[model samples]
Target: MKVSTLRMALLIMISIGGVNGCGGSGSSNTNDKSVSPTTPLAPETSQGITWEPGVFEGASNFAGRCATPRSGVDPFTGASYPDVEGSAFEEKMWMRSWTNNTYLWYDEVDDNNPADFTVASYFAQLKTNGVTPSGSAKDNFHFSQSTDEYNTLAQTGVTASYGFSWEFISSVPPRQLLVRYTEPNSPAALAGVPRGASLLRVNNVDFVNNNTQEGVDALNQALFPSQSGETAVFEFALIDGSTLNVTLTSQDIVVSPVQNVTVIDGAAGKTGYFQFNTFIRTAQSELIASFNTFIDENITELVIDLRYNGGGLLALASQLSYMVAGPNQTNNMAFETLQFNDKHPEVDPITGVEIQPTPFYQYEIDYAAGLLTNTLLPSVSLTKLYVITTGTTCSASEAVINALRGINLEVVQIGTPTCGKPYGFYPTDNCGTTYFSIQFQGVNEKGFGDYADGFIPSSSPSFEYEVPGCIVPDDFSHALGDVNEGMLFAALAHASTGACPATTLAGNAFERAAGQHKDGLSIKRPDALKSSIFLQNKILVPINAPK
Candidate 1:
């Protein structure tokens, strides 16, 4: 289902007339649990994961960073806290960027409250637009959390994990937590956890008990342990209905954002296929390499797989867009313009740095090496693009689609609609928490960025995918790049013939059970389970909190 560009444009135009133009926008202690799950006596021998070729890997840097200097007094308790300047700075940063500070609940807030609530939570309490229909979905999803886990991922393009992402179909008693996909060679894979395997229990605790808080807490503890190398017992049932128990020790699993790069043969010459998992700095090297292959093959069409990508750096998005469109088309085109609140729409709300449009970056930036070197970008000089997406595709990922389309390039979006986050943030850290509020709205070249409800696919009839192709359902049964893979197959089929296939998007179980579970109780998704899609290179500028 591919929506025509004219129709999409009209939709955006209509939405812009009525939208609020972008505005701004808790915890309970549960029964104390052991810091580490009780160790099991005997563990089963590990088996090597049967990995499909081209699955990505992760890496990390041993070099440490000097912590940014910060400190602030608690707004509620008047207790001057030192070494916590980031939180206070983060609060002020939001005060400047929130699209609608006019409607905040600042005057109504009590100055004297619990000491537990710091500048981050206090500023969070001020988000009022979330109550309205078109407002922010103010939830823990709007928090600022800090973790070494994400740092390793963004910097080195790697992360520590059990090597699998779990999806809970339901969140209550009788709820089912299934293995979404096991990273090749991940602990979960080595322990025999496969895609569609039902996670039965963790450390003897049922995945879902009638008690919501306790069950979630236990699941979180097991799923997202604080440190690597910790071991836990996992009980799961495979798709074939065989239930088994395996013990897995957390390891520094490298999570490569780029999954697969290959050519899908088609009657229309050749189509370059790239399964991109995230827009990280580490991906540039691989992208360059893949494009070199495409150049040699003389492939003009492309299919980009971003089904599971939760989004990352905007800089990388700009870089990829440049590679796709090439320097000629990218030269002066504003890839993106950040729209802040009415208060300070023209200047940097947080950094006081000049608010400028981010042009298509011609070079790659690697933060770790602290160097900006120009590499020969494999420029396809594509006039059209095919982006494989899902509801999970968001933030900077969406930016890629929007930016490409903004420049008059034909962009055919396949799979489910994007996660609908044109909004992004410069991750602010306060008290070891990375906070991302809807700081700004991103508009493309034509000034069209009205995708708050997500990009709906036109089911009017279209091909599987060719790149420069159409929208379709996500198929998760096979490994990426395999002809059996749904999205890739669609792209290949569409490339072979610029027409729709007689395909049935029947029973998209993966979409049916991704983070949509609300088991009788209000289940707030933590950042770890589902991360916030973000733009990189944007960081919090040091600012003092209000007295």
Candidate 2:
């Protein structure tokens, strides 16, 4: 009954790809040459989601803008709208449970209408039904029905209640264990694991006959034994019929959510690459460190892959943008903007005064307080850039992409369309939840590509006909199920030949889902692939959307 169960379910449901990449384009240690190739590959077949003329055409715009609640109330203050809307309930709840930090309860008892059977009533009913709402609930019952209803009811604290917990079901065949790419330098990769590898077993635990959920449960238990200083030795069977043993030492390694420094094969002796991830707290410093490493390498045609990354901490995004654009370049446009409901204007925590909402981007931040410093990170003003994208790219991610593209930097998209999560959310804490919503839209200096459902890349990358085996890179062979790594390879080839006819785009249904244009766009309707692309191509979709 604890909301953390609901949070995990929600995270899984909305987790989408958290953004990361795999594979290594042989290192080149810098020339600044550009390669514009003419690929003769056939166009990818159009996926079902075509440029169908309709309103709320894409998933993100519909989800981020239309579907989500436009307003919320401050549970504590009762001040609605502009004053205080929804709290960051999900985030806070997640952290609380994750940290085992707090115990809170909510019920559907109505203050005015006592018989309404408020949250309190819902709890009573759960007790009657023999369910305990406790922190340990996460380990036993994964939130199920309350989850389904929460999706239906955007707000968390509502009187109406339904609950779902994981129930022991009949024995089922084990599913292929899958671990996605999270960081370019993930321990999996540090141990030479590649993306797309199926984790068949952990430490010799055969999942072929065990329940898939049990396998995952076992894996997590081993990987995260305690809150801190957890270490484990894991042996994995890859889909390619190979096995690897990796010892992961847990030392509170900061999950550098953002990865930096990428290399795309460039002309003769150059590499074209780009790097931009999200704005977790340590983003700026990590990016700076990555930039240093990249400059040290000899790369030629550089690409700034900022396709689907929704915006995150403004300062972080701006810092990276400055590094690329250079110190001399003007802060071309507002880094970000926010809007408040007319009813609940936000008050400055320091000044203790009602803050005025403004449309101008500059006015939103406290520039006078030096909070909006204009210092630049190191700038590598590469002219031509191949931006890898998909529909999921959004917010601060889009800002960096648009900012560079506006300067006429050759920004060639290679994946799918990008998600339009442009509006910046000013995180507001309520009760315990962290509330954020689409408040205002953003535009580049040229005033283009703002709040658009997605950005269609100019060119598309093709997949390889001879599938690459999905084995951990260290143990990878040509024997596993056919995988189409050629798509990314084609993008790399584009840096050299300016044409990689060897690879062709995925068929039509995905074309529409990702975006109209071919280059590095993500498949919006990726779920559609479960029945089609997987059936036809036999290729697993990339675990992560293009950066």
Candidate 3:
């Protein structure tokens, strides 16, 4: 229903409560955008009353509806509908109210007692039913308010927020595995696998013609079957007709989400580089370490690379800005403001007695270290924060780009564009599965981020190569080289007399073909300048490469 209509209905409901009921601003309930349980069914002092359960629409795209049975027949061949195998639809319900910020479910609707079916009563209900949510259910609901409830579910151990998910699929039929693009610094990257090679098998299992998902799933399971990382074997068939088996352990190694920290080395000395890979949860720590490392190394030119990052945690993205741009830096709101599901059951501030829950979120900076540390953490001073970007950088990754720009950081971007993902989510659970949806929206100070189409890089890189399709074991044609030795070489060459070596290219092959430095003192550029490629502070900045 439209918010205006819902507000009218809520106002009418309040009027029925008598004289003291109309105390709130005559604002219609529909006008409230906060996702919390603020609707008052009982009077201010009322308590312990059973309430009826109702389903409310969640964010768009999920089609605000409960899980209902959907039966279908086999489409490929003749098969009876509903009776066909592998035809099952989810049967769950999701509800959202001001007092219930998450999507939750009840075993079954309690028509006889709807009020008792609400999420607010879930704790009490679970106790009465002698049931507990743990193991699979606990992992599904990563965030829970009840300490006891959380402890019980955590026993089996859940996949931490930053964990990886992989899908296994069968082999490619006609194409045969010609090559694989193990992104620079990816798992396949660490295995010393070059581009231009072939795949033989996964963990000794022969590749089936049509089991792509199975292959991916198998990889994930083998690599991270539980909370701990494990080693998995990959057998590759090179295009040269040679085969080799490589073993790689799935270690909990944290990727630098951010890279290329340097200051412009030329007369202008006005540019810098900083590349962000993902919004992964540890981005905050990694970014801090990077900036400090840059400062220690005396790098002034800045060229941020976010070309291949797909984004992860939004909170870390916000914190990254503070490390690079300094404190008191408020540009785009970190995450969208979130309202609590209810006024948590706490002793009243004035009377010291439990009361009905009310609105609790205060719009302000809630740093990673809470209020005390929010003011205590040290901040960095930066004149500019240039971002090197591409279409793959998304979600929380985009948050950093916008946040840096908001704080007036001089950001000169080079590459293609960005993956537009502006909203962030707080995962919740219901019916033994986790579901995440947009809970808040953030806009830069200039109000720029409706770009579902993605952000265009100010300067385009010179070449573009597919990430997943590049063959890593044998192909060196697309490798990133010394120009990418963590600094902007092209910018550096213009800043100094040095130039890139002739062999350096923009693809992965550059790594294998890069020429050694004269004495490891300056950035390198080709003598002929044939590639239109130059080194900025010894870092490789792209001119343009289409997604």
Task: Quantify how close model 3 is to the true structure by its C-alpha RMSD in Å.
Answer: 20.2
Worst 10 residues of 1 by lDDT: 5-14
15-70, model 3: which lDDT tens digit per residue?
A: 00011110123232223332123344343211222233554333221222223222
* Tens digits of per-residue lDDT for model 2, 1-547: 1111110000111112322111012122011011111133223222222222122122221111111233575443455533222222222222222211111111211112111222222112221011222111111111112222222222221111011000111112333333434343445457765444554445566543554555646654553333334556665555567876776654323333444345443343556344443444345455666666556774555545443243344444545655555434434343322332332245422123343211111111221122322333555555555555543455455556665555554555555544444333223232322322222334455555443344544333232111111101111232111122333344555666665334343333223211122232121222211111100000000011111
Ranking by TM-score: 1, 2, 3
Give the whole-model CA lDDT for all candidates, comma-separated: 0.54, 0.34, 0.34
> Whose TM-score is greatest here?
1
TM-score of each: 0.72, 0.49, 0.47
Candidate 1 residue-wise lDDT, 348-388, digit = tens: 55566556667676665543433334544668899988778
Best by lDDT: 1
Candidate 2 yields a Cα-based lDDT of: 0.34
Candidate 2 worst ten-residue window by lDDT: 533-542
Better of 1 and 2 by lDDT: 1
